[model samples]
Target: MPNSSPKFSYIDYNAQTVTIKRLRQLSRLLDTVITVPGTPIAIGLDPIIGFIPIGGDVLGLILSSYIVYEASRLGVPKKLLSRMIFNIIIDSLLGSFPIIGDLFDFAWTANHYNIKLLEKHLNGY
Candidate 1:
């Protein structure tokens, strides 16, 4: 069967096209997945923002949704998108609590997890 997982296509946010590249294209300066060649200054935002109170965590959750929405728009398969959406929902719901929420966010790498799911389905790994 044809691939049903989502693809990292282009996102027209604010009149600019944003390509969701796994490591670099979608990668930002402070992405969590920094490597040897990656700049230390650009570490992932997971740690930094998790320090914020409820408001900060809420903001993070909102920001994270953009990727999933973009994936849906790219005509990714419903099944894959559903799984990604499920992760996001759970992350947000669990992340809304007090101290435990922060802990959940730290442990739940929803973006990474969703990306892995996409890669797995795409590569048949």
Candidate 2:
């Protein structure tokens, strides 16, 4: 008789863990890792890079896409994937503008949000 229980793949789990760790590092680098000198506010490279002419926002979009790709690999459901893509789209679209977009990037933090979503999904929630 064959076992009916699902067999967990240790290799897959290890791969997923590595991916999550890298994504978390990327999110922190882009979203919130620095403190303003005279204020309590924290910021990251994403908004600062948004000050670049045209390439900055594009770069952000590309970076954000990696998370979505990883999520897909991890077998995230369609609904959650849609939400993750939406977050990236909103961040990219808003971050494409000039001054306003820079401000938006500062506040949006889409990668952080997507990471949270990924965590929720992975946790079987």
Candidate 3:
């Protein structure tokens, strides 16, 4: 019988190249897409939507978790992965507050931080 599999397989993801590019774009979108007027501070949808009570934090958690999930797929070390998780957990927990949580989100760019960790590992740092 002739092979019936598709041309592209799951192994074709090319995590080192394509995945990194996509993750970088996602990190930027989640953590720094918007710049505060007349200030150096910038933020993205993570905090903006975080103002939506329970659902907002849940959404942020899911999105932040995606970065960690991709990092694991990229073969990031367990130690580093744990650190990334810690960042996400902290972001989710403390960021669940009302006023302070939003403020925390403004300063805590967990996705960006996680991406940096991934790069450091890839760069052998």
CA RMSD, predictions in order: 7.8, 4.1, 4.2
Count of backbone clashes, every candidate in sequence = 4, 0, 0
**Candidate with more favorable, higher TM-score: 1 or 3:** 3
Worst 10 residues of 2 by lDDT: 2-11
Q: What TM-score does candidate 3 reach?
A: 0.86
Question: Which residue pairs show collisions in model 2?
Answer: none
Q: What order do candidates take by lDDT, descending?
A: 3, 2, 1
Candidate order, TM-score descending:
3, 2, 1
**lDDT score at residue 66, model 1, on the 0-100 scale:** 71
Query: Better model by TM-score, 1 or 2?
Result: 2
lDDT of 1 at 48: 51
Instruction: Give the alpha carbon lDDT tens digit for every residue of 47-112 in model 1.
Output: 357567767666666666676776666556888898988987887788777788767765677777
How do the residues 4-116 of candidate 2 rate in per-residue lDDT, one tens digit apiece? 75543333778889999999999999898898899978788888888888898888888889999888878888899999999999998988888988888888989999999
Score every model by TM-score. Answer: 0.61, 0.86, 0.86
